[model samples]
Target: MELEYDTRYPSVDDLRERARRRIPRFAFEYLDGGCNEDVNLHRNTADIRDVELIPQYLAEHRGSDMRTKLFGHTYSAPFGIAPVGLQGLMWPKSPEILARAAFKHNVPFVLSTVSTASIETISEITEGQAWFQLYHPAEESVRDDIIRRAEAAGCPVLVILCDVPTFGYRPRDIRNGLAMPPKMSVQNILQICGKPNWAIHTLLHGQPNFETLRPYMPAGLNLKQLGAFMNKTFSGRLNEERIKPIRDMWPGKLVLKGVASEADADRAIRLGLDGIIVSNHGGRQLDAGQSAIKPLASIAESFGDQITVMMDSGLRSGPDIARTMACGAKFTFMGRAFMYGTAALGNRGGDHTIAILKLQLQQVMEQICCERTEDFPAFLVRSEITGSAGSTMSNR
Candidate 1:
């Protein structure tokens, strides 16, 4: 983690800007764009911003701790990197880079089923700090094989993505022809021409193929063909029956991701799963879905003890992370933020992003007179347009 460069941009947007400049346009849009009208996507961040924290002053300034325990394992931070699909398309060997950084920081790193790197590779790099996120395939044998691979790789946590039964309707991808393997259209070729460094890296890396899927794929498939195959292969929908086998087989923690409604939470609790990530797939899956932070309070109130309620989407900075925690989120995860960091700084991205979040969270704790993770929810305040606010000393 080198902070030698001027830390002018503390926000995720700052890193995004750098990332936009560093990578090609098509790749950047994959990380930046959302489904259909993108209303839910914009709302994810805007809703978090509306939250106000009441600052407490004149408290004895002392040491602050960000360490949090989840499912018996203690992590250095209360946040982790959310799994993102086709990460190598954004930056070469992205999962590996993020996994290594998370391992070094003593935090959790999630590996998506469709990400560029294989589970075994990430497991080796992260030394088993990695958790696997599955997009359930229709084939039971294939799904079971993947589960076995994850277990063999020493992944303690298994995250089954319940949303995304169908792929999000991302208009930017359609326009850019940014499908699975990615087509070299005239426009894409022109875009890559402008990004000389990215082009050179791509040339050297041989265009970021899905290493995990190669063995399972048929012979002589191009990028577009691979994309179509993946689209056809996955079942997308996850239900009680699909989850039962996973719960039975996975000896370690079993997490259900993309959970929104109370019904889903109740079902997850009944399934005897270890935890459920309260997310809307980063507002990418359903266009009309509720903001992740909004329903969290009620969900936590309803099923907090039965299952650990974690959240992702709408989290950019440390304050946003703290805001989610205040609203009963046991843990927070950010996908695009770290991607922006890696895209902006290449190999140095994860370290810098983690550093920035740590700094921001510490400042929030200092102002709120809060020290440990458990004291966070007490500072939570519910409001209308402003959403939630942290209670200041005066309110206390």
Candidate 2:
């Protein structure tokens, strides 16, 4: 893929700043804020940055390739667009934009159960190649139907969330009325008036709703009723009992997102999961929990042999993706980064964000003398390595 992006916004940080200016205050905070204190949110990126890579200028290196194989697909890069809820709130038709970009790039795009786009729509856009992440519904019937829909849509991977036993306590969202029982206050309306571009786009797309859940939801429910229906419908926590049935019936790659401990990783292996994504729900849940990178090193070292170990949360750029893979993640994903891209540049956002990341990562590989995405661990600084690869580096 050609490395082309709006040079005005060359970096993810630039996209984030532009997005902050473009989107409404309430929506931006919903996409950007974390749980109480946001300690873990900040900690996650801080820890990942602490990892350093060593370049070998003298080593013989042909060229760097970012292609990686996971579950049965060899994606264009080691990263994919992560699943994010309420995507349309941040930018109109964001799920579709990202899905199309990802498909064109030959990378994975995961659709969230609560995202604005429905399974069938995204499936049609991606030609049924996108993955689907489910929010464990309280009703067994609802869960079964959603799973069936995903299967019928030809989603290759089914990601079930294990975190978010309860929604995080986000002060900004609460103050902005983005918390449960979502509302459109006069203040929000005034803010929407300020961003005419976002306002017009949202109007054209129609107000965002749980489109995937439309078939199941009762007709004619307002915001308050929608919030109530969401709270009453999802269970949010996963145990063996909840997962065993899904594993039995999915008949495709089953992944557990939000894994943060070695014990949990081991449990996932025993439960016959195909992969585990080490995440803290993007620090949107468990502000007090350890940063995702910390558990990622331990879990990947201990259990990488048994199952596919991937990660998300706190990753922002291509260098961050390299750092995460060097630390032992087989694959990486990001949610806010792509959203920021869309919010900043509208329709061009998804393609631009992917382009930026690919170019950045390719540069890192060339600089480090690494030849392949899987070879990143070999370039990890000795002091920074924390896994079995680190323990056995003397042999290399």
Candidate 3:
């Protein structure tokens, strides 16, 4: 049976559902859950929904342009694929699939430090369109070695994740017995068996080994022991002293992800970071944290001139991308949403996710009478958010 692309998974929710059905329970929960109570996860999406857009009418909105310039390159859309760890676990060869898709669509696909594939693999797959996100191991030598690998792989940008001071206490993971380097269990085996397609894909590919970690990992360890090794090896906390070597060594645009406060934004600027993602690790780290969009306007206002202030966390669609742009983010990235697409459709996931977001953004641009990407910030109304409604203001 031939599947129609348009009708199969129209929305992110639909893709998420399909992904849930196709992937194992433990893997799905790990991707979906946030820290502790998951208050911040709910808040991230809710807050984005709460802030409504005031559509402008009676303006010649012909030929809306979604093109955006960031880090000295023009992107088809303002959004890019965010770095998600253990992508192969979500779906077999997910990093390669996503990187190829992003390359075809002419957008960025970030590779996580803990991802199954290494920068070199992604570099080949993505044709250097893949950006590397470093978790910054506790040891300086380890960090330096990783940075050298990224540079050698032709990674144009280095994204240092700054907010993972410690691993979040996700109850979902605890309940599912899920963490990095997943262990095999009867329940997990049953779940895998239920999705024979996924199981076959994984088996044919030989268990989705972490090709990136082959150099460091010990021999003869199963997935469970690998998990323990990773948990013990990498330090969750990242600081300035740790960042100095990376900033000094990497010859590319440096970004500090997981910046949620003005203090952190200020620090990013001081450290000479090329950009900063005003994210709370997609609300995965702090359950009570505010939505990534909420602090963006203020942060952009304070430091947009000094540094690039991009954002991520709760962006669901193109309109959501527009809304975040209206708030303040120079560019946006989506992690779970794209992963949902990849997990939902396997080989076809990346293209479908990009297609959906591009169409959605085009619709928002047309409705809002926004002709260009830069013009969106100008139409954003700051006062309507405060109350009386219909009050429009220029960019703050």
The TM-score leader among the candidates is 2
Task: Candidate 3: list runs displaced more than 4 Å.
Answer: 1-5, 180-182, 383-396
What does the lDDT read for residue 230 in candidate 2?
A: 92
In angstroms, what RMSD does candidate 3 have relative to the true structure? Answer: 3.0
TM-score for each model: 0.94, 0.98, 0.94
Q: What C-alpha RMSD separates each model from the true structure?
A: 2.2, 1.4, 3.0
Give lDDT per model, in order: 0.84, 0.92, 0.83
Q: What TM-score would you give candidate 2 relative to the actual structure?
A: 0.98
For candidate 2, write residues 120-203 as lDDT tens digits: 999999999999999999999999999999999999999999998889999999999999899889999999999999999999
- TM-score computed on alpha carbons, candidate 3: 0.94
Residue 265 displacement in candidate 1 (angstroms): 0.2
